[model samples]
Target: MDGADYLHPGSEWAKEPDDIDSIDFSPTVTIMYFADDDTWQAVWGGREQLGEFEGTREEAIAWARERCNTIRIYSPSEGDIVDLVPDE
Candidate 1:
């Protein structure tokens, strides 16, 4: 606590949040492009390949936005983990 930078597990600085829903939770949806198929897939939870959906990039984005509040589209050029739906 002296340094006032590090947060220990049980330290007072790490108090439990009162509003859990307000937290910026990670996206449970991921849209990936398959070059072999020339289509995009909207994967649920992770890259485990669950809940398949094949479409164009715009169509995939629309599909993801309709079903969930957040989505992660795979960006090869940019950095990983760019949320389609950022926390307000």
Candidate 2:
């Protein structure tokens, strides 16, 4: 498989990569929208608490996307979405 295969949705690498067994994909930032506070907070890895933003969900995702490859965005009423933003 090619390098791009690693990023493909149904590619072998994306499925179950066997090449780098020791690699670790961790510390993915998570963005959550709080309706009470009317703010979007970017939490790092666990609950380290990165920063709060006064913008839309897309902006929060873009912010988290800039810091890490994987992101978990949560919405108050719409549930949550996990995204694996590929590195360019």
Candidate 3:
């Protein structure tokens, strides 16, 4: 199917989707803002998330920095992105 055996079901090549929520993705730290609740989130190692009133952009940046000296801050809404800590 689709000219690809991998795309054919029961071809021993098709597999069921894995549980992504149980899997960790990127291994970097990044901060994201939620304007609706005025909350900032710091995603740590893509494994955990911290969301709290320490939620301002500055606060979020600080929080991220404390845990990881090198982190990335990006704003999709403002089209702004900057790697606050330069790579060494």
lDDT of 1 by residue, 1-88 (tens): 2211223444442467787776655546667666666777776644343465779988888777776776876554542335675531
- How does each model score on TM-score? 0.53, 0.47, 0.47
TM-score (C-alpha) between model 2 and the true structure: 0.47
- Candidate 3, lDDT over the whole model: 0.54
Model 2 Cα lDDT, one tens digit per residue, 11-82: 333355555556554667756555655666666663345554546666776777777667755533333334
What's the distance in Å from true for residue 4, model 1? 38
- Which candidate tops lDDT? 1
Which residue pairs in candidate 3 have backbone atoms (N, alpha carbon, C) closer than 3 angstroms, thus clashing?
none
How high is the lDDT of residue 10 in model 1?
Answer: 49
Q: Point to the candidate with the largest TM-score.
A: 1
Q: Per-residue lDDT of 1-88 in model 3, one digit per residue for the tens?
A: 2212213344322344477575545555666555567766666675555332247778877777667665756554433444666531
Candidate 3, which segments miss by more than 4 Å at Cα?
1-27, 46-54, 76-81, 85-88
- Write the number of the candidate with greater lDDT, choosing between 1 and 3: 1
Alpha carbon deviation, residue 14, candidate 3 (Å): 25
List candidate 2 stretches off by more than 4 Å.
1-25, 46-54, 76-88
Q: How far is candidate 1 from the true structure (C-alpha RMSD, Å)?
A: 11.8
